[model samples]
Target: MTRSGRLSRDAITAFALLGLIALFAAMLNNRPQTTLSGGFNVIDGDSLSRSGDRFRLVGIDAPEYRQQCERDGVHWLCGQEARALLVKLLQGGSIECRGNDRDRYDRLLVTCRTNEDDINAEMVRRGMAVSFGSYRSEENAARAARAGMWAGNFERPQDFRREEQAGSPKGQDLFAAAADFVKRLAGWN
Candidate 1:
């Protein structure tokens, strides 16, 4: 407020900015929740495709397709194993996914079920994936049982991606990693 008891120009600008941010938050919260059901093609441990659309299992992070882990001093393709488990879970069953959000890759972030089994939680329980924002109990159980990746040592998928990107030509990797770190900090991951 200025001497005249009216909002100053800077105060008005700040209020306008705050209003815009609130509106944006409301719009995002109001996005339509979607449910998809059908046979899906497993793209990886945490990704699926039906028809032409891609979906990512919500609140889980799985190994990259090329990731490796060591158990008993022997290297194993943990990424492949994760994908295989997902495939097995989908076998001889109906698959359904529901969500109201999309990831940075534009894939729908969904909670999926197969024949009444929650695939997302199952994956974490089996140690095929780690909890990103959900399934803490399942992850704890998997860790306690030394199941899947919990049985061995491996780089996190996100860490692997960051390292791989950092190895790319020029400084693009740093920029990308910085952007990703910022997104993570902002809870946009």
Candidate 2:
């Protein structure tokens, strides 16, 4: 204790040292056990292909390539905007991804970062994406701020797909476009 009855210098220093140690330990514990590091090309807002491997940014869902959303009574190309924003983020540096599972669509599910910034979290924070699997805090913040899709009415990507399938002629909706996208990506067509 001192004049103000607070901790003494030595005691405060000891506590600070302990806090530092704990913070270091926590950082070590949270480090990704496995990571994929390399140059990547942005496939869409939440997807990238690195070294021929397609990875989907886990815990976030962005609009589809052709999906539209209504904002202020006008339709906007939210998907294109999301893709452009992701491209901007990627321009900052290379990305590193870490995760093991693959989605049913044959895309690796991973959390990616450019340097120390989490791309998935940034997308949700900016309203370019909605929390899908886990990342609710970032999405909540964006929603509270009325960012991205939160600014207007928009269908969830999955819901949009379902509706497209149900409403399209002969149940073939957007498949041709998606296939063309893949072909163009792979230089196959």
Candidate 3:
């Protein structure tokens, strides 16, 4: 407040900025979810592209493209297997994805379906992917069955990415990089 009993100029400016931020947040929340439907190009186990737009499947996490896992003392490219499974799931049908959120990478975060199958849940159920935020029951079934990666020993996808980042020339500390990577992976920022 000013000596004249009015809000000072700086205070008014701060309030205006806060108001704008609130309005922006409201607009984002009010936006309707979008649905994308078509044949999709598989990018990885948990991602796909359609018409140049990339989408990350919601509620699941798959291995990095070069990640390896061990089963019965034999190493295998589990990431490639995951991708192949995703491709197999999308075969012979058009896919549909619906969501309003985007990841930091600007890929739409979507729940995808082909025919009557929930693609994300299927991935977790089959153990090609782990449940990130949904499909707990499916993950449980996969674990019980000892299916896919669940049958082997493998690093979690987020842990693998964090280690890779920490080893890079960026010079970030392992703990800090791990924290940041986990936050991004969990969509906390």
lDDT of 3: 0.89
User: For residues 5-79, could you state the per-residue lDDT of candidate 1 as single tens digits?
Assistant: 455776788999999999999987898989988788998899999888999999999998778988989999999
TM-scores for every predicted model: 0.77, 0.72, 0.76
Scored by CA lDDT, what does every candidate get?
0.90, 0.86, 0.89
Best-to-worst ranking by TM-score = 1, 3, 2
**Model 3 off-target regions past 4 Å?**
1-27, 171-189
Model 3: colliding residue pairs: none
Error of 2 at 179 (Å): 8.3
Clashes of each: 0, 0, 0
For model 3, give the 10-residue run with minimal summed lDDT. Answer: 1-10
Q: What is the lDDT of residue 88 in candidate 3?
A: 95
Candidate 1: which stretches are off by over 4 Å? 1-24, 170-189
Structure candidate 2, residue pairs in collision: none
After superposing candidate 2, which stretches have Cα over 4 Å from the reference?
1-34, 169-171, 177-189
By lDDT, is 1 or 2 better?
1
